[model samples]
Target chain A: MAKKNGLDGYCVPFFDDGNKSKFSLASIDPSSKPFSTGSKETDRERLAEIGVLLDAQQERLHAQRVQRVLLVLQGMDTSGKDGTIRAVFHEVDPLGLRIVPFKAPTPIELAHDFLWRVHAQAPAAGELTIFNRSHYEDVLVPYVLGSLDKEERIRRYGHIRDFERMLAESGTTIVKCMLYISKDEQRERLQARIDDPTKHWKFDVSDLDARKLWNKYQVAYEEALAATSTEYAPWYVIPADSKTHRNVMVGELLLRTFESLKLEFPPAKESLKGVIVE
Target chain B: MAKKNGLDGYCVPFFDDGNKSKFSLASIDPSSKPFSTGSKETDRERLAEIGVLLDAQQERLHAQRVQRVLLVLQGMDTSGKDGTIRAVFHEVDPLGLRIVPFKAPTPIELAHDFLWRVHAQAPAAGELTIFNRSHYEDVLVPYVLGSLDKEERIRRYGHIRDFERMLAESGTTIVKCMLYISKDEQRERLQARIDDPTKHWKFDVSDLDARKLWNKYQVAYEEALAATSTEYAPWYVIPADSKTHRNVMVGELLLRTFESLKLEFPPAKESLKGVIVE
Candidate 1:
């Protein structure tokens, strides 16, 4: 592994060391075998077909007037959050869907409790809300950047857990995802930005400086997952080096979650009178 | 024409009409040719095919970062605003879209001008916003229910025209649609609600009372349209008697509007330097 400055090329340490150990993939190892060989391409086609099923299921969820879904996507810069959202939800009804991207807190937001802004964006009953990047930021970025003191960060972890518990009590189901991409892949992507003029606008030299701290961020994510993953809202570590894999995984995961809800359209109150196809 | 309630069936007006002119098929005959024998099947197939095209075109528009789109869907109770939204926007990227149902104004909303609530929901640049019944409610529902006096109703038409113009200036393109279903068809739909327990919850008997004043509403709609339809936001009179026709017309209209916007994705900023996609 390459080393730069005070950072290891492939390892990031942003969270408490105890949390990093939980991400040790017992059965899914990057080095064991090629996860994306020719078979993976066929798997992608199958997933797209299931994506249609996901769309219909989502529609039924809307009509059922039951639970609300909150999809939380957490990833490093250029980890394909935007691309994945576009692909997976492209065929779902716009009526009951909402997407909110959380940027850095403004002065007003910082003045409130950490979860205040996140709560306001929650979906109402019978709707789906996608968080492009969500409350996990309170842990990941702050810890990585040392924006808060060690004591402050620990207090926030407790705050987040309580806030999520409140959401669960209120019938909000959360699906959190951390898109895992290797440093080699990230470097290649950043280099592509420098090499291709059409992509240059997306590249910031400063982003590479942050890339130097990649290992630290990875450690932080692992810790956050270990601490916050609960039965009500589980974190799924998705392989996101390949855009296709992330999209298909997210779609399949959404389908399974919705299936578990067992939603159906509310039954009409009376008998059919004069409704005919013609 | 079957007469009811001492009114000539031919003379009964359409719903959602505010003050302008008492319209009959006499002057414009805007309704398209009535279906010939066996044409319903052909129309149905056309609708499904259009759904595919609409899906693909919406995806293209989203990826290309083109002009914003506003779909204004207005209809009588059960005339299918919700269904139309589901059908037409089924394939759109949820991140790039929003759907807002204009309900009876809340107290804060009522305190402001009618357009205040509407302006808040308009789509941003490079997005699509669908209003399942929109600002037009200021003209439609209020007019049909006789909530506003003649002088007040006429003044609202001017406010609506200017509000739309402002949206256009802010880079939002508007597509306004009125779903025209015959009174007999509406009654049949309502009766079906009573007959089917699954749909009974949707029935509101008072909707029939509103139906009784349909002719007055039609006259109101004709006047509103003649005065407010402008180049920035052209109104399309969709033949909504058939669900197939309604879906295809709305889908094609959206596809054509996006095509006219001449969109292209914002090009990649630069060649990848520190980025990678494996």
Candidate 2:
């Protein structure tokens, strides 16, 4: 399990037919810093250390070329999804990491099943892929917008679980994280962007419309996470109010996950041990 | 034109119906270092400087989201394409750079016209894409292996020029580089890889077969470059016997291309100027 820094406490309980009521999003405080080392400086130091280790691990993963890793990040607007990616992956080899930002579905995309576009971008062997926002949006967004009924939402959840299980059984190691943040935190972050006129390109009035439905969205996330969290693809509730804490905890969680794989470089080639080139 | 460091001399003369014999690959010395700063330390310092500038330029490119940039790299197997990418792009934002390596075409890729797979990977607006080994391989490899006749090769070259012209007209800024390395340099590099057992994953005895056909490949590259270099997409011969020199020259060439685009950040949105989050 390679558990350290009490990361186990953050794992959402695995879903089962009879355990639906055992997990609640409201039970976890978004502002808590369970994994922090009590100071911002120390937390950043820990992050840098983890970054180096992740770079080495990723190189080995690329060398082995047999397994894949997928990190799925889900959060509300201004909850720091983009910031977390930039900071946490700052030290990873750019050659080995592929970041796919899934935007609103296009006309062609809407014509197909929700997972059609997503399946095409799944990590190939020896690749580490990050989904800035992923197929989870299919369940969360439409349900919150009243376009999906409960019966249909449950079926989509079943589809997601089966699809993810297939990916895991084949060789992918999946980790899903919901970056939980307080409503007050979102308000301040949005206001900061507004204050900086140069950053306006990243802002839109529609973002506020989503914020207005914050509570409803949270409810949607709770249901979706509960229904989809399984032994193969588990979800973690990341307390993300503090940016430094968020980056460190996510890095720690990923480092531990990679460690569990026990990745090693491929055995040295016996045939090439003493060969000479002309 | 943002030219500095005598870069103009390295440009492959623009192709035309009549200047067929004006440019020769043999004329350029692979060991030359016109861009070098005399010492490896100073060259590295200069590379670090360009890396920072490149990072800023790429940030603006991603922010503006109107124009695209594509860098195509081609060379013999051990001419350091992978190493050059790692060194030159070390400081650029990983999110902004997409490195697409073209391996030997798969059966599916072979089923289509040569450009079919390549056109799909063209840089989208606001992207900076690098093709590790590109469509140029179609002309180089097959010609060297006697799989394609001269007439067909000429036709493919025309097809490539038209394809690139369309991409340029549609707002892609293209820069291509052929990493020029002497045969002795390649021999040393291949031998080093063979001697290190851990590096065998990147080596193949078949690479020696290609080395034996080096002269044929050089002639093929000469014909392809002379026929395809154009006003829109230009190719440069990068003398690459010294790794630091190759990275610096390539970096300098790309920096100049990006500078020519005169990219700027999108203007601040008046709508978001004074709004406050509720």
Candidate 3:
């Protein structure tokens, strides 16, 4: 079967009203099942090949002085943003990668515009900045909490889109992904946390309240993807039910995005007359 | 052959002259050799021990509860901060470590107080944040360049100490290291960079201009250290002539500091009775 946009035929179908209830992921996404049960040897071999390709592409990227990448991952708690980043950039040089995890804003942050804190964290050229949760929290948390009026929420949506566009204009390639997990999966994970004393620290009783608003969050995510997805910064809905599939898909997507960038190391400064890489 | 506060015995006699430079850099401080040419194997073995110790400490830090570690590295260009971090943390779990490299502030950063940018990068509990260059740069860079008057520089000195104190109060264990490299060694390294094309990318011609004021910077560093070093965030003057020695010392110091915390895994919320580590 021909893959959809080279996504191993696992592309998220365009949101449709008729499919709203059909969005349930009771089983693994059919499109991703191909490599799910593949032999361990075959998987290892594929990973090794990808690693070599990634190394060459990263080398070229450092040399060519290409645009930086801004990867924004948004999802509900335990939706696998951290795990995805770990699996995706497992082999990448830490020097070239930056992860910014935004927590509740401090007093100083509250005094400024929502974007102020985020603007300071943008990656420089020729780097990758991954946001475990980004400026979207400004909208997501506020929207879910209903702290902002509908009009105010709508206004902020445009502001976010414009801000992302500005980042792109300044030579950042933005890839935003939302790791979507079903309520059933979240319940199972949270139950695992409650059942295992080793995971107790991760459970805050308040989380169950959020779990009750699962349908609300699903609608919010759909709205977020529809509103903020732009040519400069597109959104990808990642099925995060299966950790292995999520890991492999995120890695493959990153490899594909980086491959598309024609990067090369900048020429050596003329001030050095004798330096060589070898 | 008694070690003084874990420093080499060379430090005891020098305590009387606390005003005297702690640095033994020949070209930079003109008093002692930074490299130990003898007992290389002992140093290497010690470094391996330190590496193992540090790994254990870091694991405990991660498990005990997330604690933030802010490691500040300051020195003139080619002083080996980048190289030191690479060697010391090469095997560290990337999930728990962050290296923040500071440069000239962007326009937005400049608009805010200088500390704003630095504050944003502070690690959450349970992370090791390495500052290749940190807020100290505000004082070091400005002092060395003579861009700030004495009054302003002194003011910045107090500000930095306070900022660090606040960071420490907020559960961050701060370890600051100054890589003391001699002028002759720096010249050799600079020349090597000029001689090798691969290393050419790191060389900046302006380093020589800074070399001319090397002594002035040394005086500045001494003053800054004296003014700022405290019981909580003491400065480690590392002998950096040998790359191996420098890395080993840093690794040992970090390992020692983290071990002193006596971290334990935060008890998990749920029982992990059935889970397997593998």
Candidate 4:
């Protein structure tokens, strides 16, 4: 699926056996618009087209009731994870799509294995599920706060890879995207929110603390992505500095993935071939 | 809320202490468009206007995070429960909206009381939830199938009323809607699905059996609506034969309900007043 429109260029190389030195987060420019048509009008037109096609594809997914699709989104604050979902899925039937947002783990969540809460929300048969912020949080937040040691972080990465492999082997298709944005872009977004008091509800004073550790989070993401981007659950680096480009790229990638599934409405029921409703 | 646009005319009268004879489902016309502006184009325009307003209202509800809202939709097969949600919520932010669809119960759901599964899906503070089909099914399906005797059915209605009242007292505002369609409309809709091979996935031969018992189901609905409609959670009958009219009326009713809440974005956080992201 990634081969379409050179999307493969954005996919992280599949993790090798402890040879994770080939990938570097800094090498990718978040502002690049390789998938953009260079015209906002044209890009939006494409996005609308993708929305209609996605709506149709999702209907087939819901009809067949066989395979499951999961999309995991990870990004820094103000990176447009929410925006991407709204734009890309604007036309999909809300009934067929389930969006699960993971907030800070509660005491009960913290009491169990990290995957315990996550596994409970996995997509059912013929379902398309989105994980706004997912199990990756377990690795990202603690490591940046110096709560998780290097050895334990490495072990957690192994656990994630194994968990994802099990899901992929169980009739589920998985795709992960990391919405990449530049520091300067985030500054503008954060400042804009602060400028508008109405948007203050979406901002937090502690978000600045995360900004202070931006470099550390980037390194953590790099390590996690390098260790866990396997053949079954690859991560794509989305250039999200351009909202239009980010939405279009993600839509195109998903369109390609769905097309590969070769989904169709189940064959007409013979029992009702000529039966009339009375 | 129902006072606006004379929507009160469509509301099932509140169930008095024990006098439930004021409401009758058969008195309402399935094809009427009392809310329509006499043109399909105008009705659609109004629906679009309501959609935008609903989007803004939902955002405020989310920002406030102090109140909860639940919309319960009950309907027979092909009554447009799915269609109404798709049309009315098209513009609302998917992040703030949760759509829960209830299908037939599994062994586990049937093992416990019916409300157990529903209570688990109730809206949390700062949420707007829609139950595509709800516990009303416990009454409608069983009564129509002759498995539930009248005495037990009356007990169940009281149980629903008390449960909803408790939710209302706890800060959740609830609105229930029944999509009313004519039996002839159902025949046409079912036949249309049969004529289109791709739609066979949506058609079940059992749906014809339900249609054969249409009168019984209506009686059950009439009794349920009369017994359960109350000040805390009212039931509104939506004439759904005209798809455009059905969408518009539902939109108008919900818009009025939301406006009654006088929802506004929560006051800007004092802590974020002058703090700048660094």
For each candidate in turn, the TM-score is 0.79, 0.96, 0.78, 0.97
Q: Assess candidate 1 and give its TM-score to the true structure.
A: 0.79
- Point to the candidate with the largest lDDT: 4
lDDT of candidate 2 at residue A17, scale 0 to 100: 45
Classify candidate 4 by CAPRI docking class: medium
DockQ numbers for every candidate? 0.35, 0.67, 0.29, 0.73
Superior candidate under lDDT, 1 versus 2: 2
Q: What is the lDDT of candidate 3?
A: 0.70
Q: Which residue pairs show backbone clashes in model 2?
A: none
Backbone clashes for every candidate come to 64, 0, 32, 0
lDDT-wise, the better of 1 and 3 is 3
The parts of candidate 2 lying over 4 Å away from their true place are: A1-6, B1-6
Tens digits of per-residue lDDT, candidate 1, B1-278, equal 21221212222232234422444433322234232223777766666666666555555556555467788887777677877877766655566667888877889999999888888788866667788888777777778777888799778877887888888887887877777777677777776767776555456566667777777777766666656656676666666767766776677667767667766545654345444533
Model 1 stretches with alpha carbons more than 4 Å out: A1-38, A105-114, A189-209, A267-278, B1-67, B192-213, B267-278
Candidate 3 Cα errors over 4 Å, as ranges: A1-5, A8-37, A40-66, A104-116, A138-156, A274-278, B1-5, B8-67, B93-95, B104-124, B138-170, B215-223, B268-278
Candidate order by DockQ, decreasing, is 4, 2, 1, 3
lDDT of 2 by residue, A137-228 (tens): 98889998999999999899999999999999999999999999999999998898899877877788899999999999999998988888
**Candidate 4 residue lDDT tens string, B1-278:** 23433588888888854547878888899999988899999899999999999999998999899899999999989999999999999999888889999999999999999899999999999899999999999999999999999999999999999999999999999999999999999999999999998899998888999999999999999999999988889999999999999999999989999999999897777777776667
lDDT of each: 0.68, 0.89, 0.70, 0.91
Cα deviation of A163, candidate 4, in Å: 1.6
